[model samples]
Target: LTFNIGERPTFRRFSTPLNQKNLTPFSRHRDDTLNDEIQSIRSLLDRASSGGDRDRASALDRAEKKLRAAQGTRKSYKMETRLVPDPRQKQMFENKLKRLSEQLSQCANDMKALRGNQQRGELFVGARGDQTNVRGEMSGDEAGNMMINEMNDIQDKTKSSIMNTKNMVSASKQVGEATMEELLRQREQIRNIDDEVMRVDDNLNRADKLIQKLWQADGHGQVHTVLRVRQHAAARGRHHLHRDDEE
Candidate 1:
C-alpha cells in the first residue's frame, strides 16, 4: 500500500490547463500571492516589534534571523545581476571608479594645501654647533642656526605688529573720548540756550504787563496817542541805525 501526500479538493471551481506552457500564468499568480502573504507577515511582525510586545519581540527576533539568512542568499542574487562579468560593462565601471579615486586624491591634496597655507612658522637653527645631523652634511648646528634666524625674524615681525595694533587702539580710544566730551559740551550749550529762551519769554511777559499798566494810566486820551507815536518813531530810528552800521 502507498500513501499519497496530496491537497484536499475544495468546492470552488478551478480551470484545468490544456498544455504545460499555458500553466505558466497560473504558476506566476500563485507565486505572486505567496509573496504578498510574506510581505503582510513581515509588516505585522514589524508593527508588533515597534509596539514593544515582549512575545512579539521574541518572535520577531527569530523571524528576523531567518529573514537575514534569506537576505544573505539574495545578496548572491544581487551580485549575479550586477557583478557577473561582462567585459565592456566591467571596464566602464572600473574607469568610473578610477575617476572617482582621482577626484578623491585631488580633493585630499587641495585640503593639504589649504592646511599648509594656514600654518605659520619657519625652520631655522641655533648657535650651538652639534655635529650629528639627519641630512648628513647639513648638521644639527646648521639646522639650529637656521631655526634661530627664523624665530628671530618671526619675533621682530610679531613685536612690530603688536606695537602698531596697540597704537591704533589707543588712538581710537582717544578719538572716542574726545567725541564724547564734545557731545557733553554741546548738550550743556543746548541746556543754556533753553534757559536763556525761558528767561527771554519771562522778560517779554513782564514787559507786556508794564505796557498794559502804562496804557491804563494814560486814561484812553491824548497821552496814549503820544506814547504810541513815540514808540513807532523809536523803532524806525533803531532800524535805520542798524542799517548804517551794516554799511
Candidate 2:
C-alpha cells in the first residue's frame, strides 16, 4: 500500500502467512478463505462508502467492485495511482477561503454598527436629562423649590444612570469586538483544518483508487493468502476484527 501526504508517497507491504492448525469461521478450504477475505474487504469498503467523504467513498466502491471481479478470476494485479485536487478542486477551495474572509469582514462591520448605536442611545439619554434639570430651577415658590430640589436629584441620578449606561455600552462594545475577533480567528482556524482535511481526503481517495486498480490487475488470489494467515494467527491467539476503522 502507498500513502501520501502532500507530495510524498510512502510504500508499505503487508503479508499474511497460512497455518494448518486453525479452521476459520468461513471454512478450511482455500475458496472459503478467499470468500471471507473478500467479505472483510467489502465491509471496509462499505463503511468508507457511506459518509461525508464522497470522493473516498466512491474510490472505496470502485476498489470493492474490482476486488469482487478479481475474486472470480483468481489472479494477482496492481493498482494505478493518480494525483488529487485535479485543478478544479483547488479552485473551489480557494473560493471557499475567499468567502469566509468576506464573512469575517461583515461580522466586524456589524459589531462596529452595534457599538455606534449603543453610544448614540447613551448620548441622547444624557442630553434629555440635562434639559429637564435646567428647566426645573426656573420656578420659585417654596413648593416649587422642593419640587426643584427633587427634580435636581432626579436629574443627578439620571445623569449618573446615563454615564453608567455609557460605560456599560463601552464595555459591551469592547467585549463584542474581542468576541468577534476571537470568532473570526476560530473560523479561520476551522477553514484551515477543513483545507487540510480536504487534502487528506483527496489523498485517501487516490490511494483507494490505486488499490482497486491493483486488485483488478492481479485478481483475487491475495484473499486466500490473507484469510489463511488470519486463521493461522487466530490459532495462536484470539484476534479481534475491527468493526469500524475508528477503533
Candidate 3:
C-alpha cells in the first residue's frame, strides 16, 4: 500500500504471513466481541440513566475508547489478506462493524444528553434551595424596609435626572435667544450697507451722465457742465452734514 509520484503504476502482491494466516477466524471472533460490547454498553447506559451514577460519564468515555480500539483492529484486518473465500462475507463483516460503531455512537450521544439534563436539574435544585434559605434568614419587616430603600434611591435618581435635563433645556434656550439676537443685529447692519451702496451707485450714475454731456458740449456748455458738477458736490456735502447733525 505505497505509491510514488511521476512513475508507472506498479503493484506488488504479498503472500499472507504465517502468524497472520488466522486473520479470518480472528476477525470473526472480534466481530462477536464487538457485538457483545455494543449490547453491554447499551445496558450500562440504561443502568446509569436509572441509577444516576456520577461516574457514568467516565464509564462512557472508557467504552468509546475501547470502541475506537476495536475499530482500529477492524481496519488492520481489512488491510491484511484474509483466508475467507467469499467477497460477500468480507462485506458482511465490514457492515457489522459499521452497525456496531453507529450503535456505540448513539449510546454516547444519549449519555451526553442525560448528563446535560442532570447538570441542569442540579442547578435548578440548588437555586431553589438558596432562595428558600434566603427567605428563611430574612424577616418580612427587614425585606420590606430593603425594598423601600431601593425604591427611594430610584426615585431620588429619577428626580436628579429630571433636574439636570431641565437645566440643560434652560441653558439651550438662552443660547438660542442670544444667537437669534446676534443674527438680527448682523441682518440690520447688512441692510444699512446695502442702502449705502445703492446711494453711492445713484451718485456715480449721475456723475457719468454729466461727464457724457460735457464731452459733447461746445466751450460755453463745457463751462456750464463744470459749474453744475461743483454745485452737485457741494449739495451732497451739505446733505451729509445735515444728516450727521440730525443723528
Q: Pick the candidate with the highest lDDT.
A: 3
- lDDT order, best first, reads 3, 1, 2
lDDT of 2 by residue, 1-247 (tens): 5766785777765453333223221122333334454555545444443432333335455555545553442321110001112356335434433443353344334434433533443344445464553322222243345456668889999999999999999999999999999999888866766665566566556655655665677767864554555456444332222221122
* Candidate 1 TM-score, true structure as reference: 0.35
For model 2, the superposed segments whose C-alpha errors exceed 4 Å read: 1-147, 215-247
Task: After superposing candidate 1 on the true structure, give the runs of residues whose Cα lies further than 4 Å from its correct spot.
Answer: 1-137, 220-247
lDDT (0 to 1) per candidate = 0.50, 0.47, 0.65
Better of 2 and 3 by lDDT: 3
- TM-score: the better of candidates 2 and 3: 3
A best-first ranking of the candidates according to their TM-score comes to 3, 1, 2
* Residue pairs of candidate 2 with colliding backbone atoms: 75-218, 76-218, 77-217, 77-218, 78-214, 79-213, 79-214
TM-score winner between candidates 1 and 3: 3
* Residue 177 accuracy (lDDT) in model 3: 100
For each candidate, C-alpha RMSD in Å? Answer: 23.5, 56.1, 13.7
User: Poorest 10 consecutive residues of model 1 by lDDT?
Assistant: 117-126
* Model 1 C-alpha RMSD to native: 23.5
Which candidate's TM-score is highest? 3
